[model samples]
Target chain A: MFSKESLDNLILSKRTVLCVGLDTDPAKIPAHITGTTKQKVMEFNTSIIKATHKYCVAYKINVAFYEALGMEGWQILFHTAEYIKSHYPQHFLIADAKRGDIGNTAERYAKAFYDEMPFDAITLSPYMGIDTVAPFIRRGKFAIVLALTSNTGASDFQLQPMDDGKPLYQKVIEKFSEKFGRDEIMFVTGATHSPMLKSVRSLVPDYYLLIPGVGAQGADYLTTLSNALNASGAGVLINSSREILYASSNDDFEEAAAAAASKYEF
Target chain B: MFSKESLDNLILSKRTVLCVGLDTDPAKIPAHITGTTKQKVMEFNTSIIKATHKYCVAYKINVAFYEALGMEGWQILFHTAEYIKSHYPQHFLIADAKRGDIGNTAERYAKAFYDEMPFDAITLSPYMGIDTVAPFIRRGKFAIVLALTSNTGASDFQLQPMDDGKPLYQKVIEKFSEKFGRDEIMFVTGATHSPMLKSVRSLVPDYYLLIPGVGAQGADYLTTLSNALNASGAGVLINSSREILYASSNDDFEEAAAAAASKYEF
Candidate 1:
């Protein structure tokens, strides 16, 4: 359970709002790690964590890359989460799973991430509505709903003009905020949509926003920080995946990852 | 890839619109299996598949249940998919994995289910927009998007009235239908919302609907069939999970599951 106060304390003490995204791809890793896909991914993750943990406050493990590998991939996911929890207890951990279903199914997913694996937060898709998300918001765990994604496809339903003149994403943020407080709920607002960050901040000024698309996806960090920063100067966790994880394909990949992470310091 | 014509042919040949949901829970399986979580789940799934495959045309595997057991669970999931594909290739396999993300991430998920596992179709959440869904609609594969789920939480967002004098679910159906044809896409409309089936049918009059919430969820089957059946008399694949999967807790569980499944025959 990463309380708002504790998250803020980490942000202030670490002097960084960076959340390293472990979107580890087996095809992209260096040729030096001659092992099975699971072994290579785990080794890569451990190295990256060892080098970058001091520079960032959180680690976002994208579930898709692991899911691509089948059962072996899932083992890597569990090991990675366990490694983070056991080694860096102070760092907030997120499973960037983007999962939601019916009430019963949602409960199982919540248990998978929160109880079985012990992640502090899991990203959720809000298409199925409130009940799909309610199961994730317990005492300490948080459900970060996708509001404005960084991709071009976000304009499909999320940016549609509703009857009230507000875009659909605003309605999503507003409705979710009504049910959860700053600690239990967060919104995934992409860095590409940095201009809209002010609008998002206006709606839920105190809530934490997990901003992605900063590095590899080519979103301006200065613009995002200018609009998304809250009164506490600690309301957003900017995630950089490929740019930091695959900083170099050489022997100094871990050192390169750490150097890239340090560039995101506040 | 389940073509509209082939799927319809199977529906007629099987003489039923039933899809047995393999939501195999380790805690719910009969004690006689006496195996590890992964082994027990695989055994239960195999038994149920053998018992009920003759009565139904499709098998919907809810990914969350398998995801709960970590990597071992995923191996069971793969084996289950393989069992159905090898022995009952006629049966339409739906990976009830309600997954969607950015375009690149969504592509990996599609490859995971379609290329890696050989599921005919995969359930998707459309909250992120068109790019999130376009990756899943390859040659023979189908992307069944969640429009109006059968859960109580559907009221939270899916049932909300849009500015165009239509519920949000209707808007979702309309937009998706415009982009993908009936062959490439399907919609998940819960059977519990039987009254809305008429409206949904009217919207996507030709597209197949993967309707859950029958049997155990207390949805009236006759009403659902009457409202959802299209001109071809094959427009819906009704999914019932718990009612059929856990029909008995004793030695007769497999026989009971078959008997329970036979009752849904049209």
Candidate 2:
């Protein structure tokens, strides 16, 4: 599990806050990797992880992609998490499973991600409020709450004004920031919403922000870096999923992925 | 897959709206059921479902408890879903996995729950707006959105006043109800907040509401039933997990669960 200091040190040492997202879709795997769907996916994940580990300081594994593969998917998910944790201990690992529930259930989810699988951080939905987040706020573990997303649907509720005259996302960031420190909490402020990232940084100046939507979602990387970085020049984990994972749809996938990851150097 | 018409029919035929929640904890299993934790959990789930199926019109499987068990836990979950679905085809099955993510990721989750597992509905956290839910609103399937939860932290955000003077939950219900019909969507209005049930009923008179916090959470059953039911005399699936599940941590646990489930007749 990576703490704030450890994460900052890693970021400074690596000279990049690039968090390679393993949102691996089996259908997108190159035809060259022949086996059952599960085997293909496992091969793709390990290959991608091996190829891109040095270019980035973290790996964000989206649970949905593996889960979609059914029982075999869970097997792949478990193996993938272990592969990353044991093989690359220095890299921060995130379970991009945006799960939110009541307290008791939340504890189980926290256990599933942090204990069952070795994820340093797990993304959470704060709509059910702070108790849903409390179970995951352990030492050296982070509960990355969704503040403002990159999706267009973010405007539907996240941008809606509350009684305090600020948008709901601001209130979420404000409230959660009060409960947990920079070590135990981070906010998912999307790269597409770079201008708003300044406001997010203002609220929690030192806390890391996991920024998605850099490549496929069309957010300018330099703009995101300029607006989101903290005084230490290390506060954002810019994730590129499909852009790097499926950088090439052919036999040269490993090389293509490596090249693509290196191209996003901070 | 159970729809509004089928759910209503089942409720009328069974003369109850009870949804027995399988929030199974391995440690809580009876010592008499001797095996590995996975086998114990599987036996417990099968026995419970068999005993309570006659009394309840639906079953709500909380994903957290199973996910907590790690790899073998998923096997238990897969088997449990298959057991109830194959044996009790008439009952509405729900994955109480308050999952919320962006569009593409949401599609994969929808596939995981609805396609991979034979669930008729899934509970969703609506904070990310409609896109997180759009994937699950298919024909004969329902998307149960979180309107107001039973947790103490609901006051932190769900009950807060938005710019329109209505609380965020009301706005969520209003907006979602307009987009999806009664057959396609249901709201999770907690039983602990029964007084607000009238407001929810007023907004979507025909849509079903999955009410938690009934037994162990200490909400009066009669009050919840009277306030939440529609003109058709059916609309709520009142869920009771702990009280019914751990009715007796002994040899007679099966009969105890049946008796406990029958006591909560709508």
Chain A of model 2 scored by TM-score: 0.98
DockQ category of candidate 1: medium
**Which runs in model 2 stand beyond 4 Å of their true positions?**
none
Q: Clashes in model 2: which pairs?
A: none
Per-prediction fnat: 0.66, 0.80
Write one digit per residue (lDDT tens) for candidate 2, span A184-238.
9999998888789998998899898999989999999889999998998898899
Q: What digit string (tens of lDDT, one per residue) describes model 1 on residues A1-266?
A: 68887888889889899999998888889889879888888899999999999999999999898888875777888999999999998889999999999888888888788877869999999888877899898887789999999999888788877777777898899889998899999999999987898999989998999999998899988788889988888888999999988999998898899999999887
Native-referenced DockQ of model 2:
0.86
- Provide the lDDT at B213 for model 2: 95
The local distance difference test score of each candidate is: 0.89, 0.91
Candidate 1 off by > 4 Å = none
Candidate 2 chain B least-lDDT 10 residues: B1-10
